[model samples]
Target: MDPKKIFTTILIWLPSVIITLFFIPNALDKILHSSEMNKIVSNNAILIITGIFLLIATALFLYNRTIVIGTILLASYMTLIVFIHMYKGKSYEVAILIVMATIFAAYIRSPFTFQQKRNY
Candidate 1:
């Protein structure tokens, strides 16, 4: 593979992997009612629903065809988190960082890049 393609794949896949890993454990905590999530959300129903959404979003992100949708879903979720954190008078830096990183990766991996069309 071309070095550029390899780099782009790394940029996309690395963050995707990291984001998925980040969300999975949190999702599990919510579903399993673990202490990690209990400190944040108290409602079981909300936790379960959020956890399920995270799993689905991660699945969508990992699959090439659904990556765009997955990015949107995950980004939206993260954005919501940012607001929630701010509302609770907590730092939202992590959520904001993830959202920005995900958007950057999505741009880099976008199928509609000008170079692809020009190469055809």
Candidate 2:
């Protein structure tokens, strides 16, 4: 394997894997501990739904065909969480980091999707 190919692969996948690892456990926690999550979200149903959404987004992110949509979903979700944390007077750095990671991974995966095409 070419060294350049290996480097590109790591650049593309490392952030994706990190973001996946970060969200999966949080999703499971929300689903399994809705009562605990109620302190943060105020509604158990919404918490579970968010968890399901996260799981779906993560799955989409891992799928090559649906990665763009998944990245959008994950970034939106984390952005919402960031606002919630700010509104509640909590530190939102981690949520912001997650959002950044999600976007970074997606950008690395599909750089062209983010660029406007020009007909010369």
Candidate 3:
């Protein structure tokens, strides 16, 4: 296994699992404090749906068959998080953005990916 892919998968998987634990309450707080999350996914139904997607994405990240999709999902998620922070006029831990960007780069470099058009 590529060391970078291993690192990226670990990075995406951990926080995704952690976020699933607090999705509802955190969404509630976001809705109260910021307008972006509410605007994008206001109702509990959408929140639940996205939350479930996060959970499943993390699980898929654990298996080889579904990892690219998981990386895409997680990358898009973290991008949105960065956007949300900017939209709401706030800044967040730079580490988060850096991690997200690094995972994205690692996924692109992963030898298991057909899109890379190379073999390890």
Candidate 4:
């Protein structure tokens, strides 16, 4: 077994879990309650698409399958989220984006990514 990838998997899952449990909910709340968010999502199907993606991403991450795909989806949604916040004049969006990127990078580099590989 490649110990490095195993470590990487842990790193990836850590954020995946946090974002799924914490950040995602907060984001969804804003997207749901704020009139501004409703407009962004109401007119643009892209936002809704990404919203659905968050659910898919969480599911994939939880099952530890198709994680890279899940991460890619998450990255896209978060990127959009950051920009949305910035457009709304939220100053902390960039910081959140950076932290999320860092966590994602760790997962992308984790050893556990090689789920099909066996210990030899």
Question: All models: lDDT?
Answer: 0.79, 0.90, 0.58, 0.61
* lDDT (tens digit, per residue) of candidate 1 on 1-120: 699988867876776677778878978877887444545767778778888988898888777788788889989999989998999999999889999887666666665731344554
Ten contiguous residues minimizing lDDT sum, candidate 2: 34-43
What is the lDDT for 27 in model 4?
47
Looking at candidate 1, the ten consecutive residues that score lowest on lDDT are 111-120
Predicted structure 3: lDDT: 0.58
Clash count of each predicted structure:
0, 0, 0, 6
Write one digit per residue (lDDT tens) for candidate 4, span 18-70: 66775467446544644456545565455445556666665665555566666
TM-score of 1: 0.77
lDDT ranking from best to worst? Answer: 2, 1, 4, 3
Give a tens-digit lDDT track for model 2, residues 4-28. Answer: 9999888788989999999999999
- Give the residue spans of candidate 4 off by over 4 A: 1-14, 23-39, 43-50, 98-102, 105-109, 112-120
Better of 2 and 4 by lDDT: 2
Give Cα distance to truth, residue 84, candidate 4, Å.
1.7
